[model samples]
Target chain A: MQGTTRTPSQPTTAYQPTDRTVPTRSPDRASYDKELVHSILDEGYVCHLGFVRDGAPVVLPTLYARVGDRLYVHGSTGSRPLRMTGAADPGLPVCLTVTHVDALVLARSAFHHSINYRSVVVHGSAYDVTDPQEKRTALDALVDHVVPGRSGDSRPADKKELAATAVIRLDLDEVSAKLRTGGVNDEPEDLALPHWAGLLPLRKGYEAPIADPGLAPGTGLPGYLSAL
Target chain B: MQGTTRTPSQPTTAYQPTDRTVPTRSPDRASYDKELVHSILDEGYVCHLGFVRDGAPVVLPTLYARVGDRLYVHGSTGSRPLRMTGAADPGLPVCLTVTHVDALVLARSAFHHSINYRSVVVHGSAYDVTDPQEKRTALDALVDHVVPGRSGDSRPADKKELAATAVIRLDLDEVSAKLRTGGVNDEPEDLALPHWAGLLPLRKGYEAPIADPGLAPGTGLPGYLSAL
Candidate 1:
């Protein structure tokens, strides 16, 4: 009701889903909302990047960041996925997915068991980020992604380090976010059955910081990390 | 070291590394040991399933279980990824990856900043498991994978529920595990820099279980969940 209603003045950035971004099954769960997609991507630290290599699908976990309508991912310039995006080429085709498991839905009947999760899938080609200014900004966004405000707290990369790192940017086109929320969806007949049914929520957190072995004693933990 | 050395007479069930399974970027971080690979798989609850759809890459998040040398993934028979396997052929060619982000390695230099993670990449075709018995076992394994002893606690799937679920399994034949552990690996010259650098560990845990709003009053919370 209230949550579903959107005001005209509100800047809604819903994505435009292409045939590939649309869900073939459970179409009701798919969302083309830009705000939802960006929120899901921002909350997640790492994403699974799938790309075709020699006609076979290859998926790898890599860090990513969402800045406005664009997503940036970086790796060692020599990394296979990064190297696949050649400068002169049209860029590498990729499917990047980020998922957060909110809870485990335990249904009375095994058939209805599922997870309460939020996931975003992006379909696009990743172009090599060549400009010096854009590359620096992308790299900073990545650091702040893992831990917000981290880039400001830490030192920036030098010119030599920048040369060794490669950043790839993918526009948030043909994107969709799918999710399942609330309690277990058990069958009508099974509701009266004896089996227990509920949700076991999962949470990710940061533990007490273990300073580097070589960390100078006077060097205290930064405020940003300590708060986490 | 002794851990790296293999003794004779032990069953060598290590996965064979094909051209694609090998890490092209950091080959030193890859391992083909069976024990190591299984350990990493067992530690993760979810996996990224990648496959080609209409000549484009699509990646989805799904639950999976490792039973012996095989990995089983199930979804609603109507799900797109599951339905694609039923196409007029043996099955679908898939890339399944399980990753555990252990810690964030904050290096003094941005280029060396990385996450200490353990990930397994399995490249092969997934065959539809139509056998009722195997399907039942796979489903049970999937439930147990989330929470140990959960399969025994919950009700088993009835015939009707079984008909609605589809299970596909991929062999751990062409699998390889890659990992980066310990603290940050900063450049030797940057080591003397004043910036702070170390490991920031990330942990996942279960929160308080919330009972279904409609749960019967007399039904008690299970001991297993309470313990967690």
Candidate 2:
């Protein structure tokens, strides 16, 4: 339970949901129900992590794993954001998002073209997971997040590598998942235009697994992987 | 030539080859050459556009298209970043990136779990393309970028709809493309561990086209659509 307590002195920020200008699509698209949020986070293996450094925004595409409601991201301790967050003062406040574009909505008129997509954005004050036990658990959550049953099967991190790594966690409290899934919505006047307009759906699926050339002969591909 | 001849008052950012990052991988794993860059851009239909708004960084997923070394991102004239760039002062300085996750690398050690990906990041000042002719051309590129030959087949934008939309162009100067491909790389010591380690090669391929229920009876899936 010691690892579960928050440090009282850590500064926190209030997140006001973004204002929605389009009356039809409210700013509430800026937030989502927890169920909707966790589904999006769990389904995707990678996320685009965004943070502002030195007044300029840097977006790093990285792997992320979600455990219950908390998301864990890890990298070499030498990485900029990881190093910055691990330092004493102001921890990095990040907006981590995962998205999957489902289809291309080819509207009749050029101006109305849009894509059907599912995206979730999380807002939180992120600090490095400092406690050794918590760091080990977070790293395990990350490993199992990507390959579900593999964590217990693999050797856990040793002391030296553990010291050289950094892990940060963002709770999925303030989150928003927005989705647009439909065919083209063309303006009335443009319906007669001779353009071919319809959807070109996009999908991602796993093919047959390619075993590593270096893999040992006896170790075959596991069921969880084949299921993915 | 009317659109290409008249350059806007804003100066084009020079392409400084040295400003880019040489990825710490095999040379074939990274690219900045025009053909490689354009190929990646053309294949990706969406991008993660990041910028600092107020103080914190925001990354929004949006649709994009590429023409030569320039990328066109379209939005309603009222969108925040689009409006910010269209204002009179210096346009919004933005980082635009597109990525494709090709495979998942499952290594023996937990630390080496990674993904094989191809991504392009363009760092430049983004401005609203105000010229009517150029805006139209950019829109065309955006359309054809997603669906080949669809631009010519579709009706061009009309006067009023053009006014309600904005196209922000980010030149490919100061751009970096990084990729990770190949099987998992496990540490030599972990080879004896009794765990499975290999790549689950991820791929995106079109399924049988789901004809739009609203399509006219005579209209079937186009040859290009089926071919993909």
Candidate 3:
């Protein structure tokens, strides 16, 4: 929300629905609107990256950044997923998901208890970013994704550092955003019950930033972080 | 941490590591300690469930409850994953992960920027909970997992509700907890840079609970919620 800029022209564009993107349950909660999908993806810092390993599913939490319709994830060159996406190999299939839990829905009945959340799921093949120019931009996006204006404040990665890191790009082609908002969904019969029921909103934000012990004297908090 | 009780006798026990649980990177951050794994899992409200579908991996965020060595996930009987775990089908292989971002680690160099996080990855086979007694207990755990002491105050699910819900159990056989904590890890050459570098801690907690508009008159906020 802070560092990323949205394309105004694509506000009304929607992704074409595919069989895998359509959910079997709660189909009403799913949306293919591009703007809605981007908002959900940009607000989160980490994504659960799912890939098949040894014929079994493996999900790992990793840092990701969205640039236009493409998502980039970087790691050490030797990392399993990064290694699997080599230049010679075909793209690796991955399912990337980001979720934000907004509130805990407390209902009068145990069966009705639920969480209000927004999530986006993307199914695509990830390929290595070999172009130097694109790789550098993706790396900057990754840093700013965590904290806006951070890439400019920090030293850019040198050739050696860039060589050691691997970036994988996944296009946001087959995706869907799912959300559950609003109040409790308690049964009519249970409304009169004595239990207190409503939404317990979860708040997430930054506290006071701890300055590094070795930070240069007189260095001040950047405007972006202070705004946060 | 609030409602779930730890087994005192297993304080020093560690889960036997398997090939899948061992990470290919950051080996030092991975721990097979049972207590550490349970703590990471219990503190989170949702898990990213990864399962293979049509030979491709799919990851979804869903509510989960941990009971001793078992984790239970419930959904509508017709949900995709739930339907896949029918009585006659072989157990579904799943990789369940829970992650908590503790801080945003800002470094002097963009390449070193990282986040302080704790995560647990569990690899196992999930089977439908066919036994009525286990299903009931699992359902209560699911409710209590959201709010401690909530299951007791709320109305238990009736026969029809239980019939509509599907609960699946995954044994905590192959599990590992990975953590990244503490301060910035800036390179020595960049320590003298002017950028502010350190940890921006992320705070997560509930704000005041919003009482349901139709709450019964004179109903008070429950003790369990007040404690939270």
Every candidate's fraction of true contacts kept comes to 0.63, 0.53, 0.93
lDDT of 2 by residue, A125-150 (tens): 67899999989989888888777887
Q: Give per-residue CA lDDT, model 3, range B1-228, as digits (tens).
A: 111222333435989878878778877778888888899988999999999999999999999999999999999998888888774377998999999998999999998899989999999889999999999999999998998789999999999999999999999989988888778877788999999998899988998999989999999999899999
Query: Across residues A1-228, which tens digit of lDDT does each residue of candidate 3 receive?
Result: 111222333435988889998888887777888888999999999999999988989999999999999999999998888888874377999999999999999999999899989999999999999999999999999999999888999999999999999999999999988888888888888999998999999987988999888889999989999999
TM-score of every model versus the real structure: 0.92, 0.87, 0.94
The DockQ-based order of candidates, best leading, equals 3, 1, 2
Ranking by TM-score: 3, 1, 2
Candidate 3 off by > 4 Å:
A1-12, B1-12
**How far off is residue B82 in model 1, in Å?**
1.5
Worst 10 residues of 3 chain B by lDDT: B1-10
Worst 10 residues of 1 chain B by lDDT: B1-10
Tens-digit per-residue lDDT, B1-228, candidate 1: 112222322346666778887776777678888998999999877799999877778899999998999999998888888888866376788999999888887766666677878899999999889888899889999998877677886678888778888899999899988887767766566666666778888877888888877765677887777888
Instruction: Report how far off residue A121 is in candidate 3 (Å).
Output: 0.2
* All DockQ scores: 0.63, 0.43, 0.83
DockQ of structure 2: 0.43
TM-score evaluated only on chain B, model 1 = 0.90
Highest-scoring model, TM-score: 3
Give me the overall lDDT of model 1: 0.82
TM-score of 1: 0.92
Query: Model 1, stretches more than 4 Å misplaced?
Result: A1-12, B1-11
